[model samples]
Target: MFFFFVGGVEQQVRQVLKYGAGRCITCGSKADLVEYEKVLKAFFVPVWRWPGKEQLLHCNDCNLFFPPQLSADRTTTAVADQPDVLRCRFCKEAVEPEFRFCPFCGSSLS
Candidate 1:
């Protein structure tokens, strides 16, 4: 019975790591998962489901954690980011949300 419960909980944790809030960007196990906003010199930071709080790494024998590079790619594999629809902050023209600058005017969005 205990084993079954542990297995289920681990499965849920794995799913969260894959689809829910990010696991440790460094390691893949359960992270500190802190929630806070960041401000950096007029940079419009992308709002994540859970932000701030430094990412904590989980090592082997602690929690099964995947590397940041691999995990990040897998996490977004199932979903596509929304199209950009904000005007270029510098150029003042309609631009895709994902772009870093205005395609028409070539002004930096950041």
Candidate 2:
């Protein structure tokens, strides 16, 4: 007798709740708040699907779905308080104002 099983679970964005709601933790790009669903697949075909418990942030550039609390740009108000800090246009990470290069993304600040 032979038995084989090939199945896995994956999360998918069900709907976008808000656009540009946050920043991606992995890629430092804009992320959207979205409702999500979990799907169970068998033999590459979806067998079951259920709604997720809460909304999450979805990065369009990287196709990553993550918790809202895990976003890199969680402290928007804090950044606004610090005027001397410069943000990298490429990665959106804060950099020292005097630095000519972004330490996070190696991009030219000048």
Candidate 3:
């Protein structure tokens, strides 16, 4: 008989230190400064957890966690004010005017 274990360590937000702390480098959305923890799972059950040493910027929209120093300081309002770019109606993500599809959400832009 052969058996396999589906288990791994995952990093997750432990606490939000500050909301709207910065912008995500990838998504340009509001990111929170947060403390994080590493959780070890065995057979999909959490077995142990440990707090991370440094705080990071977490984007809820993109589910990305990045270093605070790497985060951008720009606000979403500034991104929305650009008149040259077209935005998707469903995701509101900016798309090129020539694109017939939203790259972010895969929605038809026509």
Candidate 4:
């Protein structure tokens, strides 16, 4: 008898609690508050899903996950000084100056 099995956990964004305007502690790029769902996949088919709260800071650039409470101070002033930073339409992350693509979300700046 022979059997093949493939399984892994995947995270899916369920809703955006806040746009990616704040800085991420790990990546130093824009982060967002998102409600996510963790899905367990078996053989490329989703078998189980667990919904998460909307208090996580998701960094699109480095794909890092962290709690928002860790960087509460930085988020309050992330975009206050940078007036030239552009917000990504696709991900709504604040893109730094001179970046053609959003470092956080990889969206086109132009």
Candidate 5:
């Protein structure tokens, strides 16, 4: 008897706690406060999901994930102030100030 198995671990965004209007640390684009889940998949189907408690800073442009607590002051202030907001033409989502591209939809902001 022979058996074939495919398994992998995937990190998925569960929810957005807050949307920060600031530049991403990795790509200098927009980022958000996101809750994440770690999923275990086998044979292309999810077997288990582990939801995370703490919110993370996720960069839509570069796909960077880091603890928001690391930059709590900056992110909190940015979310509160929301200076120089720009809207994406394609997705109509809010873009970060001074960004050359829309982080949510990858559209040209210029």
Candidate 6:
């Protein structure tokens, strides 16, 4: 349906380095691999897409997966548009948006 734009993913990836290693989604590590799924719609049905259509992130430091950014950027126009994000007290992995608790280590933000 809607393309995020060519190499747009890379541009977004670059933003993370500026933010530094955020809270880890798994094990609450300072670094981690993030995994998530995405879907696209066409005529009211879901279609296969690239990258964000579904994905995983890998971290050399801690060897885990976690969500990336915790804060919204210039692109987001509304509070809702900002991802569901969390910060780990240790290791620093950014947790997923809809997680009830940390997916990596199962630590509760609650």
Q: Rate residue 3 of model 6 by lDDT.
A: 62
Give the candidate order by descending TM-score: 2, 3, 4, 5, 6, 1
**lDDT tens digits, residue span 1-110, model 1:** 35322111111121223233344433334443222333332233322232334332233334433333333433242233433446544323456678876675455778
Residue 28 error, candidate 3, Å: 0.9
Model 4: how large is the Cα RMSD against the reference?
8.1
- TM-score for each candidate, following the candidate numbering: 0.22, 0.66, 0.64, 0.57, 0.54, 0.24
Cα lDDT for residue 40, candidate 5: 97
> Which of the two, 4 or 5, has more TM-score?
4
What stretches of model 5 exceed 4 Å from their correct place? Answer: 69-110
Model 2, 1-110: lDDT tens per residue?
A: 99999999999999999999988766678899999999999999999999999999999998889888766553578777876767876666788888998776577878
Report backbone clashes per prediction.
4, 0, 0, 0, 0, 15
Better of 1 and 4 by TM-score: 4
Clashing pairs in 5: none
Please list all clashing residue pairs in model 4, or write none if there are none: none
Tell me the tens digit of each residue's lDDT in model 5 across 1-110.
Answer: 99998999887889888887344654556778899998999998999999977778888877777775443333354554754666665544567778998776476888
Q: Stretches of candidate 6 above 4 Å error?
A: 1-19, 32-50, 53-58, 69-104, 107-110
Candidate 2 local lDDT, residue 13: 92
Model 1: how far residue 68 lies from native, Å: 49
Model 3: weakest 10-residue lDDT segment is: 69-78
State how far residue 55 of model 6 sits from its true place (Å): 9.1
RMSD of each: 18.7, 5.8, 5.0, 8.1, 9.1, 14.5
What are the clashing pairs of model 1? 28-65, 84-96, 84-97, 85-97
Give the Cα lDDT of each candidate.
0.38, 0.84, 0.82, 0.73, 0.71, 0.43
Best by TM-score: 2
In terms of lDDT, the best-performing candidate is 2
What is the alpha-carbon lDDT for the whole of candidate 1?
0.38
